[model samples]
Target: MERDFYTFCTAMKTLDIGSAEGRGMSPQNYATIRLALAACYGKLSKGRVGSSLELTSEQEEHRERKGRHYCGLKEKGKRKDHERICIPGVAAAALSAVVFARMRHSSLEVLLCGLSLFDVLVLSSTLLIYPAMNACQNEPDPTNSRVCHFFWRSTLIAYPLSLIAQAGSVWTCVAITFDRFIAVFFPIKKRVWATPHTSTYIICGVAFFSVLFKLPAFFEITLNEYGQITPSSLRLDATYQLVYMTYMYLIFILLIPWTVIIVLNGIVIQKVREAYRTHKRLTQRNTRGRRDTDERKMTVMTIVMTGIFVLCNIPPAINNIIESYAPQYRDRYRHRIPLSTLLVCVNSASNILIYCWFNRQFRRSVFRLCSSAAYKRRASEYIRASKEASMSQTLKNKL
Candidate 1:
């Protein structure tokens, strides 16, 4: 069968070439069709020898180049990597942002603002760059315009915006932790930090500071002739790699912020424990139990969110630290970046779930929002039933 098919294709090729020339087809068009036919023939004659099976040096070189993959192009075994991560992350972030928008007036408004903002940033950046990222993962052609343009734009431009959003998210958590600490340890100052207005200011300040800090990243990235993103020529220097890259990630982004989060949350937990013990001793009644339950729920929510943030961020943070010192690891780290990004998106998106789980008020609000139309329909039905009953009674009285 293979031999027959090969002969058939060979015969078709000769006939087509001869016809192309006779039919007044341009040399360029004929050449293209010839190459296409050749490639098709190559597939059909994979195991056979002679003209079809023997690839030229140049052809072999092209094949080798196609096989050459960057880390971003790799998949998790046979599974798709980017779509699995980016799509879900974008969805979760969007849902969380929408859900949390209703709870803006709460004491935790500042944290919610930060979280929602981060979600929006993630949504935008992910959507803007998802095509490019997906293409880079799946397609080999670096010359793809959408891949080059969107990927470079996302990485070089939108990425820094995401960085600011991320920093704001971190600082927001830090602020919440600190607020909880103050509320527990120093009650008098709780009013100052935990207020909605104060949270707004803090959120704004975080945004401002993050923009200021992440500005350096914008200048450090550039696109090559093929539209692939690479570090700036200036960033090739040892000083930039050692000082700015290393310290920027290790000290400022990861170490200090993470340390502050851990310490503050730890204190908040300790204080919570003390309060629980005191509350238990003071009241054996169910009323106090309800309050205690509420407190416990909030504590659980905070812990879960903080835990997820830390866990999801660990890989990227470690890579940052390592890549800071050893520049060679940067390429290897790119392979894992999509996974890291997915983790962060999940973390950002899960906050709404945590809110619904932990806060009764939030749950009620969400329920009311979701079931508002149903509630109205029920009310209208009840009114109609009452009117019908009254009319029946009136007619019966008249009779």
Candidate 2:
């Protein structure tokens, strides 16, 4: 009986009753076939034919639920990879910040310091706050746990903070590129305008505006009394999504910065190449050629950093565009989201390697910094040992 019923349902599903002509049946024939199928289903199920129809609907809903569950599992797995990658990325960014900070104060070094610091903030939030949020979410009774509440609140703040840091990092890259561009194009003007103080002011402005731009993000989500994180009413507004999220974020954060970085870096690279040729011609004048060589190295380092920025950012920018215009295709690209995020982390962490690879001065500064730290440690140990020996000898004399 069950096998016969299964066959009957399959036959009913195969029929194109809604489009009789397309199915090569007259309207009357279609109606008659539909009536016959309804009667058969009614008899087999021993209930209303509507109930039998509802069974198919329920089956469809079940399949959809299963599909959603599978997507969630895949996203969770990807998140684990994000967490693992953030650890080393954050450490590298911190080390880069320290190295840049300790280097001699210059417009380029100052901008590099700002870039590394912002990268540290970006990666730190991903490393620390996100994992805490995830752990809090998994707790059976999160509302009862004070720790969970703390993490939940921290996540709300961290979200906007991370965005601000990321924006700052992007603009700092722009600043670095722009500085190099000025040095290549207008060396005299750069000497006057592109001072370390000017770079500091630029970084401050970038950070301030970045914070102001992302302030709306703080209100996007809220932790309810039930301890469930939910989107706020503002997040549901179409105007907010269209104006703030799609247009504003897309324009200021991704489009403008990318355009500026690409254009300026292109000019800088061309100028550097031209300058390299010029320097080669002037090679016999060792003094001028050596100075030009240093300038070329600095310009090359800026180009490399901005190139990496553009390359790493492509994925996330695509994801952002898709989210704005073609969100229906989001699930198709969902698996790539994790890879995009990892690339951002790599971008943030890879600056130190670039410095080491491209800039001899930066490498020497880092080596000197490490040697100085080691010398300080040894000196402190020696001083402590000498003091201990003197104290022991005084005690022996007193005895």
Candidate 3:
């Protein structure tokens, strides 16, 4: 995550603007904070003014000074070498692809590239390879085997869909992280950095990134059909998905952004507490209330994203790390199984909620978008009636 910022900064330095240090720093810092905020909080503020902010109840958990730290994560599944390959590595790879792909120049090129790859993969797998592989497989004679057909279909669709979803999840996380990074680091010069146009560009970039990211899965995932043992998708021979996913979780998620989220949340939380303390002490800091509120909103978002990443990915990351030994008793706790699944699903689908949580403007915009035409008509009538009353003499004259 930090390297991305540094790379962005380096690119800016090449522009050779006379002394507009702010101009160069604007895009670089904005990009850094783009993912930071995207992962943690919500959408970029489109309004020209400071946005209406809503604080989350989750902010209380982060309010506690000494938050819990992760020791290790555990997984409980019987050791099947092939089963091991299917879930985690594939999941990680798809996410990594989305994260890496968005960094390229433009989303148009990205969409084209991604669409082309998606089509190619769909064509090759669906048309030629699948039918041929099914025909040649162990139960080739069993046309009555509907189970085999369904299984092959799953093998074709499920893994690819998972890869696609991961691409989205990664891009979403990246988008959140970048947004928060800008909020935290560049508080003074906010809009100068994160513009609506830039936000749209970044989001489109994320979509494209997912395409490129998922493209590689075609090479890795293949169907295994062994004598009616219920065929499955497996990563052919790769130890690690050996792509951007590993680099991303290792560098981007776990190491870099998680660290940044933690530290920034801590600082903002502490600052909020300090604002409480300083207000209590000097009694003049409530004047700092609006500024502090913005910071607190940022902190709330930071905390939420941190908690989400920690709760969702940490267990999986730990499970992956510990599975190095592929230890026994990996499946002892039935209690955590549901938690892990829920967290992962929630983590992937969470960006929309985070936006609604932090940005009242986003909420209003969404509400307005979803508002009924009837309601608008009613609102228009009310406004027109009020205007007529205020200009009662004009209404009488017009009548």
Candidate 4:
């Protein structure tokens, strides 16, 4: 069968070329189609083709169907894993935000609150919107269903929102690191600069700029009249891919943040160690020593957060670079993409655990918050019981 198909392809290349030229088709178009046909033939004969020629419509559709089947079988476990992690991660992030907001102990809590909220946005989008979009796309007639239409439009909106949220999360980490850096290196200046108001302003600025920067992503995918999700022409531009997707993302999102976090974290860690050593030498258990210990713990927490951010994000960064420069190998590394996304989900979700583990104050606050809620519930129940007993006594006297 393969030999017969190859022979037919050869005949078309030789005979159809002349007929195609006579039928007023341009030589370039004819050549492109011929190359596509050759690639298809090679696939059947050799089990692989490396031509990179633009596939004909039928071939493209076939490839997409095959890829979908491959993913369904291979990615079932990954989808399950995503569900396991993201649901709890969203809850944890929300809990962390509430706890941090109630604390109001320092500017760091404000930054942490912002981080937690942004992480909620990230994890929620990943959990709900993207998965919904994927399920809608898998339908036979996605356009015919109102639910699919809603999710299709939601996905376009969600794409930019997710990017904005992710950017906000990244810059919030940067802000937290910078705050620690200032507290350690410029203790006298920290009072002037690292106020809650300053932190709020920084959070607002980061949010505004993140939206502005990711606004283009809104157009990256669009629903066509037929309700099929398609990449916009802007997404297909080679210059845009190279300049915006490759260079700009690498520089702004990965390189700059990574450099700032790593360098500042190292210096802050060293300063913290020096302070600890000095306190030990003094052999003082005074309020000053306690303050130093709290500061050191905060610094350690900041370092751990930044370290996790760097580690979790590294795979995605590498994957992005690979897709940008060596796209031919994308299929080979497709499994890694889901793993990278899992790492990001874990990073966003794991901050609460980090806080609980490293910060004694955070754990105490969480315990107090839970206990307070429980106390209120119990008080309400007692009041209701007392009111019912008084009503019964009144009713018995009337009888």
Candidate 5:
């Protein structure tokens, strides 16, 4: 009977061990649990294990959810490769081709060109051939499948590029706001502050500084065993999260850029409203009427564009902030990051629509570009028909 009881207890302990491993605990968590269990059994064998061996509620809770570090991140399911590849890659490329093809038209005006440059940067990071091919080659597992597996090494290239593009987009919109502010509030110096040459310098400077600012991220990137590429700290350490989330995301991304844009655009709007209020007093004889109209259209489109940018980008900034400070909330909100990123990509893709909606010149430009091919085809047919007719007339004269 004594031997049989011992055998039964051993079987029960074996089942317990199997259960723990089956629970999908992380290696570290599983090792700690095994160590604790061994210590408990040692005490029992030594005959000193009283009811004190019982685990506390907190210990029990920890054991129950041992493997999970954050809330929503427990399941290492599929990645978002398709959404990431399709939206920014295909959509941004299509929109950029249209904008570039119409470069001779008003669609390539100063403000629109800045936005187009941002879109081009977005396209570059997203449509890289290596990563797309990697995504295609990833095999779908019948079991243990995740959200989607990604090649983290390729992501090292993508992440910094995306950061630069986002920063450049924000700064470009801010520059446009400042240009409009000068044109509306200080008309006498508008030419000095908002000239084509000045716009080029501002754009070039923004691109240069944006790359410089985000350069650190590329150096600190790492690839995990699971083929996921991320920050060296896996976005968990307080210092790393604080630097990127509280400082970079909140201050540089959300607050400063948006604040400057809002204030400058507000002043421009006020000036425009005041000018319209005294329309009768203003001279209709200003010879720069067409130029003024075009400038105003650009201002309106830029203001709307900035507004959309702020709306789309806010969630990602907020998500990073929450993940940095409150870990539990990070788990709760991790699922939202992909959605926020999609919104930002859609913002990049939809600029041509914004341009068309607010600027009649842009609409006209697109119409002209689309119809040009048809116009050429018709002209070719007419020329061929005329040549045939002339040949027939000559043959009749010879006869």
Candidate 6:
């Protein structure tokens, strides 16, 4: 489809990811989009050999800001290979841990150990890696600029790793919801139908499906002929490869799952409130008292977790809307601007904090990990051998 000019400009001016937000793009005003992109996205249109080429859209606009990922544009120096590796490592680690946690087939109570480990790994990696990241500066070292160096060799690999991990989470959550629904609506067969064996099977099916769903993304990113890591420039004819993937991400993955989560969570919340109110009424009818704090805790937790899911998803959802319907806005804002890229990065990174705040089970697991027997033993050894540190320095003192 060709571009629409007016809608694009309107979308650009209003979006938070635009010039009005104090985002940086060099040469703040430009006569053309190409000039603005070179100034803002750190690409010099003047490279001698490996110069990055700019694409023009008849409807395209350029702005002076930070997040515009005018891909492949680089300042005249070599790609600063070492500067951006940290994001990928953190991604990989989180993904691996998530897979480990969802490996349960039976005996959930015992398997909860694995789940706890997985959650802790994901939470810790996601949170820690961000602050650890070095600012993306252009390094003269070509070797450091390699994609492998950017993710694994430089800092961590748990961030991109999270794309798959999130798919796993969505699958697991859907499975859990399905499990709850079956028990709630089919109470008579609860013990028989919702047995550990059945839950195990459900988990397995969801895991396989989630993995299959995410395979495309993993494959789409690869090392190109130039020894440079490049994201998929999906062929024009490969509808399923590029455009289809984009829509799938917008509709099935982010949009559909979020919609289901909201509706189901709304129902669950309504039921919980009704159950609580009914309990209070019946108690007054019989004994003149309501349930205590523990019941209230469950109520509060249900609301908290539900809110987390929605809050964690908002950015990417916004991105999808912009990418799908607001292309002209994307164009006019210009690749020279940085607002768009920052929003996308934020979308990618927010999940770390989500589990930390809402998933009580996850937080508790992290606490347990810190206080684990192995940790305690190692901590004691450190204390016994050291003269500068003491009893007050242990994690227990803080957590």
lDDT of 4 at 196: 87
Lowest-sum lDDT 10-residue window in model 3: 65-74
What lDDT, from 0 to 1, does candidate 6 have? 0.45
Q: Per-model C-alpha lDDT, please?
A: 0.65, 0.75, 0.45, 0.78, 0.63, 0.45
Kindly list the per-residue Cα lDDT of model 5 for residues 66-174, writing each as its tens digit: 3222211222234455356545555544554565445634322655576677776675665552344334323323112232233344567787787788888888877
Clash counts for the predictions, in order: 0, 0, 25, 0, 8, 38
- Cα lDDT tens digits for candidate 2, 1-399: 544554454455345212465456788998887676445434434444455456677764554344333323222233476577678777777777788777736799888888888988888877656566545534434556666677767778787788888888888888888898888889889879899889889989988988898889889998765554567999889899899989997889888888999998887778777877777776377776677788889889889888988899899889988888898776567657767867888888787889889888778877887799899999999999999999999999999
Model 6's TM-score against the true structure: 0.53
Tens-digit lDDT string for candidate 3 (1-399): 433433333333222211123234576665664344222222212421223244355652332111111101111232132223333433433332343244333222232223223322322223222333333332323334554555454555555555554445444544445555555566566556665456556666765766675665555544333222231233433444334445544664357546765565566566556655665566454556666665556556546754675667676666544433343434333224434443554453443456468745445555554465569889999999999887997878899
**Candidate 1: stretches off by over 4 Å:** 1-102, 224-228, 282-296, 328-333, 372-399
TM-score of each: 0.69, 0.74, 0.46, 0.76, 0.64, 0.53
Please identify model 3 stretches exceeding 4 Å from their true place: 1-151, 167-175, 208-214, 224-234, 238-249, 275-295, 324-339, 348-358, 373-399
Question: Against the correct fold, how does model 4 do in TM-score?
Answer: 0.76
| Local accuracy of candidate 1 as per-residue lDDT tens digits, 167-249 | 77777777766666665676566666578777778878888888898777777888765555767876788887788777776
Model 6 lDDT-worst window of ten: 13-22
Candidate 5 residue spans exceeding 4 A from truth: 1-108, 123-150, 224-237, 280-287, 373-399
List CA RMSD, all candidates: 11.2, 12.5, 25.2, 9.3, 12.6, 12.3
Poorest stretch of ten by lDDT in candidate 4? 69-78
Q: How does residue 323 of candidate 4 score in lDDT?
A: 93
lDDT digits (tens) for residues 171-246 of candidate 6: 4545444444444456467567666676656656655666677665554554544333344554223576446557
Error of 2 at 384 (Å): 5.8
Mark the regions of model 6 whose C-alpha exceeds 4 Å error after superposition: 1-136, 141-160, 182-188, 233-238, 241-243, 282-303, 331-375, 378-399
> In model 2, which regions exceed 4 Å deviation?
1-69, 74-80, 133-150, 378-399
Task: Tell me model 3's lDDT, rounded to 2 decimals.
Answer: 0.45
Clashes of 4: 0
